[model samples]
Target: MNNLPIGFYVDNLYCFPVGPSGSQRFCYLPTTPRIEVLGNEVKARILNSDDAAVLALQIVWEADTDTIEKAKSEIKNRYPELSFINLSLADFRGVTATLNINKNDKVIYSIGPINTSGPDMFRAAFQDTLKSAEKEAVLNAFNTGESGVITIVYDGYLKLNEIADAEFDGDLATEIKALAPREVEEKGKGFFSKKHKILTPSPSLQECKDAVGKAIENKSLIIQHKDSANVSKKAKDTVIQEIINDISQCVFTKIEEVGKNSQYISSYCCRIKKTKAESVKFNLKKSYDLVGTISESRGRDIIEK
Candidate 1:
């Protein structure tokens, strides 16, 4: 198996020097013999011209499982041809390679000195770095205009046997659940069933008073209400009376039923006199629940010089 071409294997492990400051170096045997470096750590692809086979490698630094899964879903949806493969450090044992940075800079990169502290110390760091690179590559392909044609190699250092034992944090699970799409049930209602329109809640007395005050300050008032055909005439008169009592200076300049009978009620367009007083004060605490009977009820200042 080791003698096969690099593309024959689903994954290949290769290491390049981090820097000259690191210590401890050695190479062990790979489970399979085919090894190749297709590109820089950001993006690469192993290929066998004779076999017409290729395997893509993408590096990202993300550790969150949700993000990785989402990226995988997006990539699969967009490309559909490539598969994502996550790699861990344990997949490859002792491996050594000589890399030439430039004409003058040559360095030896190794994986596994089983008896030494180097592999243990660098394993976590290497895993994190690889994960980061994979995440970057995945995001670049998805978010930008780049083609989503690569199969991301997940962190290979993770032991295959231990994968089943790994678990995501509870918060991450909760977040994923929250983000997942919820199914909305479709209800079959009888033709005569009471169909209710979603209406905004009625304003409290304090809120109404504040609106009046604002209208007074702006020198105008425009009261808008949907036609409440369901509400009795007495109730509509009561609401209009309450408004008049609260703002004594304001007069109903116009009232019209504009829409068809399907409209719940007629709309009211009222004009109020602008008072020079610093504030308009009113102490009516009665609750009208106006919006409860109608779909829309709002008061605004329609400035008129």
Candidate 2:
């Protein structure tokens, strides 16, 4: 049987990295990052031992009986950091890959060598009655899904490009005032005491207002539905049945449309002020480091000069 396909996801760990100028032989530990707008603290635990720049990932996957062996072998070889168990049965739930950053502006790139196993609900369901053949047949037929998370211990943070802050209350005046790059000023004097200056700022308050207004407009949620009362119906006993003359006239088209639109609003925003975050300025320079495990065969050491 064909092995199940792997889905992808990025367990976001927002950061800002300040690496050593030019080039350095070592990566520093990453610090806990705080959301600048909301003041929410994201504590990132550092997981490095001695001098090896380590990245530990605890991958809990679900695979069926036929594909379990292949999945385990692939994971074990791809990520030397995971210490997986001897069990093959079930399906994957989700997917994705990842890397971490710190506040000081440096990207730490490496993977840990250790895979651990956990109790899966599907595998444990067949406690004592289902025979091995029955269990194998059942496991071979189901599809659960796969997902993973990498807890970064190395000290780093990520500074992404400044997009609109999504968290600000949809107040035009308030966002304009907060987003202003500079402020109005005054100096000593009473009547003529205080010297007032009119600062014509670039991207004036009106421009700021328009920008925020547009951003809000772009992120607005809209749902469309048709009223059922308008549809001519007949009272068949206590139930209302549509008196349709044509069999092709669909009734739930509007409902299905609404459901489709709802899918757009399914997930929350990121890094957009009130949302989670990502960026184009966010660079990915480490090659093979994020996915491969520590190999003694390489025999190359990266230490400070």
Candidate 3:
């Protein structure tokens, strides 16, 4: 499992179902999100860089004790909680909020992803481990009250598609792309207008993706040229990234190993190619400080563009 070394700022990590209907389940406000949740999420804690460091250590310590000791030695001094209140109330645009953890996990959980590959869907399941005092405190808060005041910071792997290539992401996508040859069972198919529409194409998943790319490029939404339909670079580029984002999330949802266990796609930090729908592998220098502060608003301003 590859641990992702990047972060995204969520305005409020507490947007669950308001009632037992289980119908309404998504929200993304660019400003202070006014969600109407019942008695929960008030315990949410807005994290600072140091607080993030603590959580990171909790994750790392479970894997390597030496690394945790070294990390603890070098982490920044704890700061006041007043510093990161801005993140708890942000308006991140276009990230799919459909990923979910285990049902047993007391933390936030979303719906399982749609995988056309087979009847079996890959859901995130964590091994049982006793939480340390510090780790317990953080989870107690992360799982508790987060209605609309606290932002979420996840430390995980970037999607193989987000890394742009198999080489950059240790052939993560290459492995998945290879799985294309396997036989799949037709399940999880949905219908509209009383017609069945399989989310994952039966035998042409890659072919369908390629065709989509070509169609999007050829018939762009915003036609730049009056005579040409595929002339708008802006709309094409924007939609292309969105497509990549969807594929990446699909990778995250369907392929449990490709998520935090692989690498993280920074919608807030990294940039996708304006001309191509795919992203490329990052040749990030192996530095502790670079990993020390994984803020999405590092190079970019915290204020929304």
Best by TM-score: 2
The candidate that wins on lDDT is 3
Better candidate number, 1 or 2, judged by lDDT? 1
Stretches > 4 Å off in candidate 1: 1-67, 78-103, 108-305
What is the TM-score of candidate 2?
Answer: 0.16
Full-model lDDT for every candidate: 0.26, 0.25, 0.26
- By summed lDDT, the worst window of 10 consecutive residues in model 3 runs over 162-171
lDDT of 1: 0.26
Instruction: Give the winner by TM-score: 2 or 3.
Output: 2
Kindly list the per-residue Cα lDDT of model 3 for residues 1-305, writing each as its tens digit: 12221322232121111111111212211211121113532211223343231221111111123433332222212213222211111122122212222223333332222221111111112222223443333343344432221222222112222211110111224323433333334534465334333333222345434533453366521122111111234544564556545444444443343322223332212223323233222221111111112233221221111
Error of 3 at 115 (Å): 17
What TM-score fits each model?
0.14, 0.16, 0.14
In angstroms, the error of model 3 at 10 is: 16
lDDT of 3: 0.26
